[model samples]
Target: MKAVAFVGYKKSGKTTTIEKVARILKEKGYRVVIVKSMHVDFDREGSDTWRFSRVADAVLVHAHDTDALLFRAKDINALFSMVSADIFLLEGFKSIKHVPKVICAREESEVRELNDGLGIAVSGVIASSGIREIEGLPVIDATKEPEKLAEIVEKRGFMLPNIDCGLCGFNCAEMAKLIVRGEKTIKDCVVLSSKPKVTVKIDGQVLPLKDWVQELVEKTIKGMLSAMKGYREGRRIEIIIRD
Candidate 1:
């Protein structure tokens, strides 16, 4: 998966530009997911979603036509893991450093607020305002040429699960940097891989057990499973050790 952010102040056309860019990418046969951040209170005081919030952190509303999740937590990383798509377009999340961003603004001053070394391109109303580049970043007209913007994002964007689990020998942020430098591949993320991994730690050091030890552990697990009444050969099981 690949990702980029559409960032700007309130009403600066970030949402509109994201919508256009998502449409353009989808029309080109790419699956896209849009993640937006809202500052104001979005839930009503006395609504079904509000009532669900009182009892649960996440509520899935499933009706005949559509299904939506009303989630209260502000964990973008968790959300990223749940969504599967070819491209992920983020609105807001200006402070996140793991992903590149396209800054949209109505004025040059708003464009200046973007962090250094984070922006991949500029867009929205400010892109067509005679300033072709800011801080050496190229400007792409998001409203008029959304396909071009989508292409740029497709070429340059990347995604990390953002869980910081460190199973890949690097945190999500470190993996993102490595990916940009061509030193790492997305498949290196163990969390997203089809095969599961087991780690052993003893006395504050990770233990790299030998192949024979691993084989012994597997056989021992199978032996224990053979004692169970409903044991099956194809079932997968997980075991955890605290110490």
Candidate 2:
């Protein structure tokens, strides 16, 4: 999935800007998912949602027009696994480094915060400052021309599995920052990398492991084989992951 963030201080027009971008992307036939990060409480006592919240690890409330999933977690990768989309418009999460971000600045000082390596554009109040660029990046009008802002995201934004599987020597979040820095690629994700077939079974039941598991097993087997002084790195190997 491709992703970008709309971030700013309170009342900096993040919601409005994201809405506009969502509409524009939808018009172009791209499925979009909006994720907002906040510290507010989302539960109301004595409601059905509250009741379900007490009994399940996750609570799903489905109505005629709305569906909500409630869980005591804030992992964005987990949400990514649950939702499928072409574009993910993130609101808040100012500290996440993997995806490109458009800043919604209401003041000049807020614009300064966009210096992080992940920023691709600026919007909101700063867009009208007659400044064409900040920190060498374009200043866009997310409200007046969301398509243009969307274009910036399409060109620079990115998404990852966010599983933090640690196969590429870094978690998904860390890998994202590396990718933004030109230190990695999608193939660096062991899950997305091509490899020889290796089957694993536990107690006579075949089971599948994620990409990181493959990495761990391959390394462990390679190490063991090398200890005998006859095995080499490119030799064929097979191993099983079991409890």
Candidate 3:
């Protein structure tokens, strides 16, 4: 899925621009998920989930038509594997450089402070100041031309696997900026496009394999599965090893 981060200080119009852009993408039939970053407590005070959180490390409230998993963690990448969407609208994460960004600002000084070579567009109250471009980034009026803003996002936004294998000569975040600037394509990302025959991840991080090692693992697994009942030439199988 492609992801775009909207980042600025509090009350910098990040929410409004994200909402407008999400509406336009939805109208175009793209499934969008907005992930907001905040430090506020989620569960209501004295509620069942809140009470459970006092003793438990995590709380899962299985409410009707919705489910909430409350945990004391702040990493946004934790949700990437759990969520399915065409686009991800990140509400915060100013320091994350892997995804495309729209910098929201109310003044020119704010724009100068926010641009860090990752921003694709500039929006917010600063867009009303009648300026066209700031630091070579387009100034888009999200309220008046949300479609235009959405198109920019659709064109430039991307989510890399962030494996940083170094096969691409640069890091994933650097590659994202190159893609946005027309210097590179998504095809340049080896991890994002790789279809490994045998994959392994320990503790949420993928373990890269050599070419010969991957072939050996794939062959061994296929040979073992070939003798199983109901096994076909191209069947999908999963194995879980636990201590």
Candidate 4:
């Protein structure tokens, strides 16, 4: 699924920007999901779900049309795997590098302090102020021109597997920075987008392979598959071994 984050200072118009973007994405027939990173005190102290959390490791509150699952976990990827969508619009999560970010700011300095390399564009109140760009990042008026923002996101937004294995010299977050800066393209990622790439993961950790090694593995797999029934040329193969 495609994913992007919305970040800004308090009351920087992140909510409004996300709402507008979601509307445009929905109009274009894309299923959208919004994930917000918020403070810990979102649940009321005496609420039913909150009260249950004191005694249970996981709490599920089923209401009219919503099922809220509350649990304590440090790994976010586990939680994310449960959600499926065509487009994921995230609010907050300023530090996550797995997805491109749209910065909502009140001033230029806020953009400077908030940007880390994953930023794809600038929006929010700062966009209405006539700032066309900040540090080479385009400023988009998400409130007035959400379609343009949505278009940019559709072309550039990316979601990376959260494993930090360093096959690209730098980690995933570092590669994400290079991507937004135009130094690297999404196809450069060895696992998801690369052509004829060989990726091996042991217990969810990616193993680094040189180019020659990848070619060797790919060729060997192709040759082996050539003799199998119903095997077509250039088809991808995945082998799973469980002991």
Candidate 5:
């Protein structure tokens, strides 16, 4: 999947630009997904819902029909796997890697040393009444012309993944949505930097086995022992060994 992100301070029109770009992409016959990120707690503290009862480090919610995800994470990488889209538009992750992005600037004077970083796909500047283009980067006018933003995304490729796994802290669906909005990234998933593997337990003993041979042996023993017991509903069989 391809991904892009929009980054800027509050009232810089990041959210408005994302919506306009998404609409234009959808009209062009491409499968698009959007991911949104928020630091605020969506669930009320005293709510009676099950999800609210046990507070987790983060919470992710998905809507398949709209192909959107709502992600909440303390860290940035919490939504990597949660995004699923041919093209992902993200809204707010500035610390991740390799994402073609648009930096929203209200004016050229507002540009600072922090804008010197690489990986910026485009920079949007708010013009007087209509959108204007930056000489080296694409510019988006948040107030007058939002559709031009979609043209920018189309020139760039799709922006995110679609599996919606919570390994990133956001559900897969939510990640996709935010990616389109320019809000998050896969590198944000610090958890994935470490490899993943299946865990096994034997005779109430946990084995720290990393090799396939050990896993195969343990699985074979378990399967054999399970079949040897003549077990049925409400009935049990015991095995005795003779020396």
Candidate 6:
């Protein structure tokens, strides 16, 4: 499924923009799912529903017709698996990885530095003064033409490739979801080779692994693979090292 997100600071009109976009996409006969992340407590304190969960030890539950419930143990990837939808329009997730994003820009000064690493698909500039276009990116006037914004999302959002190869570990779709949710880190994936490449950081310094360390790491990886075979066969084996 294709995915996109509408992200901005509080009170930046992101919610309104997303609702309008979703309506337009639906009119075009596309199936769309909306995912909203809120830090506020969804369940009331001391309510019957909350009491039942506490008593039953169930972390999450879906009431068939109602929405799904989740406990602290559930993460975004786990949640995505539960819902069925053709396209997911995410709101409030700004840090994960690959989902195209529409950032709400309320000031002209905010336009100078577009954090490319945020993996933004598009940016929506609110009604303001001194707006200028950045090369290779479009700055949108969100208040004037919400439907036109929807068109941009529909055009660029569907162009992404959807191979969930977990080479990115979370898979492509999950990576996009996490990016929109703003909960993903580069260190989470050991297999992503895309560039401008992500650098590994140690302490406060950026450093490359030493040659001896690299060799040791390779040996350790091979050992782990060998150990997996034993687990698959329901047997146990010990690795011994000689000096």
Candidate 6 residue spans exceeding 4 A from truth: 55-73, 109-116, 119-136, 158-243
lDDT pick, better of 2 and 6: 2
User: What's each prediction's clash count?
Assistant: 0, 0, 0, 0, 52, 8
Tens digit per residue, CA lDDT, model 5, 176-239: 4455455865555433333424344432222344456456855565666666656343333333
Candidate 5, RMSD to the unseen true structure: 11.3
Q: TM-score per candidate, in order?
A: 0.71, 0.72, 0.83, 0.75, 0.50, 0.55
Ranking by lDDT: 3, 4, 1, 2, 6, 5
Estimate the Cα RMSD of every predicted model relative to the unseen true structure: 6.2, 7.3, 3.4, 5.2, 11.3, 10.6
| Best candidate according to TM-score | 3
In angstroms, the error of model 1 at 128 is: 0.4
Itemize residue pairs with steric clashes in candidate 4: none
TM-score order, best first, reads: 3, 4, 2, 1, 6, 5
What would the per-residue lDDT of candidate 1 be over residues 66-86, giving only the tens digit for each residue?
988877544665567566788
> What lDDT does model 4 reach?
0.83
**lDDT tens per residue, model 4, 74-107:** 4655556556788888899888877789999999
Candidate 4 weakest ten by summed lDDT = 73-82
Instruction: Please say which candidate is ahead in lDDT: 3 or 5.
Output: 3
Residue runs of model 2 more than 4 Å from their true location after superposition? 45-47, 62-65, 163-175, 181-188, 193-243
Tens digits of lDDT, candidate 3, 119-231: 89999888878898999999998988899999999988887766667777898778978987889888888766777777887645566665678899879988988988888
Instruction: Give the Å error, residue 37, model 2.
Output: 2.0
Please give the RMSD of candidate 2 to the true structure.
7.3
